[model samples]
Target: MPRTEVPPVLVTGATGRVGRVVVDLLMDAGVPVRAVTHRSEAAATLPADVEVVTGDLTVPESLDAGLRGAGAVFLVWTVPPATAPAVVERLAVSTRRVVFLSSPHRTPHPFFRQPNPMAVLHADIERLIAAAGLETTVIRPGMFASNAMFWWATAIRADGVVRWPYGAAETAPVDERDVAAVAALALCQDEHAGGDYVLTGPESLSQAEQVSIIGDVVGRRIAFEELSPDEFRRETEGSWPRPVVDMLLAAWGATMGRPAFVTSTVLDVLGSAPRSFRQFVADHATVFIDPTPSR
Candidate 1:
């Protein structure tokens, strides 16, 4: 297949957290962007300069339209039926490069050895992208800093206590913005072709340490209380998907006695240190604040 002549980059999952950030970074770099959302309603948030398209990966015809006239594509499999040969084939024939947002599978640590169905699906996509002859960049990010917001923001906002299992478990949480920047760089430049980048934050910190950082950023005294494994499971029983909950608990349990691996890839690629957990909380402090303060 010939190169796509730098028409525009197609960003699937454009309305999602990392995708929106990627779109912004690409636009900042003056690269024309074609943003693809699953529904027309989701397109409203995209900037007016972006060309928004409604596309679904489950249906091949839907993806073909979005794949047209694009130099490269950022593939993020957010929906189910994770193995889609037609979608990969369409991208292979229509585009020059593909950057996949994937997870770590072959990490030497036992924590990453937890059985995760998502990893299986991402591996399948990586194989298909390689076999299809498209230049591929596979990015495997460690635990996301945003996960803290989802896990503890509510409790901290309400009662100043972050309740969770394995508070001593360590992780090097990567910022979503850093991940987006790397993805945009891979999409717009050829230097990262056929590269498998393992992205992580600068330092390894325990869960309790992360909570304290957030508290410092938010200007409040928040406490971290370790929950029993069974209690934690019960708390998230109906709130999260069964497989995801199981995988997280298993990973956290395995990490209890070990330290998380840290890397400087963000600094190497973006020429700056990855944003610390405190910075993330400071940037998003308003999200944890109640609009109507209770007396």
Candidate 2:
């Protein structure tokens, strides 16, 4: 008998942080991958074996080429929620399974219970998937460890002091690679259909402690200076979006007195411990270190 051929898995947001990793994992597992990107030039960064197609989530019709003959889809929704219904409808007709990258908003933890537009978007997409009757698995990851690089890398590189709010607030920062691995597993295996997994890191660490860990990795002393929420808002008024700043402030304020919500879903799904915050920092130390400094 001839060998069975696996249908390609379509990956949206193929150039994104988590989606890029998912594409690599699927390719490494000998699974065919079809990556959808808005910019044609972005496809050049993906592995040579991937079938890259141009698609925009906002315009649902653009996804037809990428969705054709795909068995499963890894959906990463970062765009606005205007065209989600049409997109979900298209996916229902095009693919058999979908793995959605979501947040742990449904978790009974104060950190995740804040007023978040992103959570609202995720919930709405989940409902859309359920109504469309597509085989789906939702991967909810809490506080990505890579957020440290986005939140503090520039400040750490500029000076040894990180001026930020909620230094005492604790969170278990899940590794993006772990999230991508679980997503890849769900996309490839039929057993994960309808599975909902909330992924977190191995341990909880406060904002200050996380900064200290980065300092340890860089072999220097970095100071954590807590800022008032209003001060933070003023500092980021022009540069950051108003809603995002408010969302972070609300979450941090709500979880100030409590430990972060931690889960073993990564270990349960991948059969290995989730990467620690220190490990994440150690691996990306160059981002936090400046090469040239004035005396």
Candidate 3:
């Protein structure tokens, strides 16, 4: 738990948005890191000193090999029940502490409480880990600021008009970097066991308002248009799961009528302020900037 103790950290989802950041942070802090991924090629971007292990979380046998000698683990639940038992079992046997990247289901807001099936899935994993007797910390992050890149990056780069559903629905979008920072701290230290931290940005903003901040940062004006829920569903059906679609629509609907919840857990844990939406936009603007403009 002290700053002087350094543990070998195994980070699952090592190539994902937050996982990669956690890996980098641990390495920067001089902690030994074992980056776990399904493909070794994905580990190429990581530091050569990092121990890259190819293992499937769905297989308990594979995890023992990847987790051998590691003292702490960072778990990101990407799949369903098929892999939960095997993964948690391995971590319980091998690791001293585990930090779970999860969602805020017990938040009591209709947005978070909307009979979410996926919430049940995460809850199941949480229960599994707790029963296994490992020191556990749960991080529930609100909507990520990075979601905008997937939702409107193409449109912003091509037509410069970002169209989506519920433009006025409010959300306190947490930066993925902040989430990763907290995860890194929890993984490297043992003091945060049994902590359920709800991570959020400093301020709440609507989708339209977030876009306006992006526009301001880029020194350009961007337009936002709302789509009917049906139209939005049809457009996004191929990309989003049905349950996730329902969850988002319900959350957005609830948000339209009420103020979003903003939390300072990132500051409380990491001793610094969470990044603003404007900061996120500025940091990732290249994703939306036009690659080729008309001559």
lDDT of candidate 2 over 147-207, digit per residue (tens): 9999999999998899999999999998899999999999999999999999999998999
In order of lDDT, best first, we have 2, 1, 3
TM-score for each predicted model, relative to the true structure: 0.95, 0.98, 0.95
Models ranked on TM-score: 2, 1, 3
- List residue ranges in candidate 3 displaced over 4 A: 1-5
RMSD values for the candidates in order, in angstroms, are: 2.5, 0.9, 2.3
lDDT of 1 by residue, 75-108 (tens): 9997675447889989988999999999877777
The lDDT per prediction is: 0.87, 0.94, 0.86
Number of the predicted model whose TM-score against the real structure is largest: 2
Residue pairs with colliding backbones in model 2 are none
Winner by TM-score between candidate 2 and candidate 1: 2
Off by over 4 Å in 1: 1-5
- Writing each residue's lDDT as its tens digit, candidate 3 over 185-287 gives 8886678988999999899898889888878877778899888889889988788888888888888987787778888899999999999988898999888
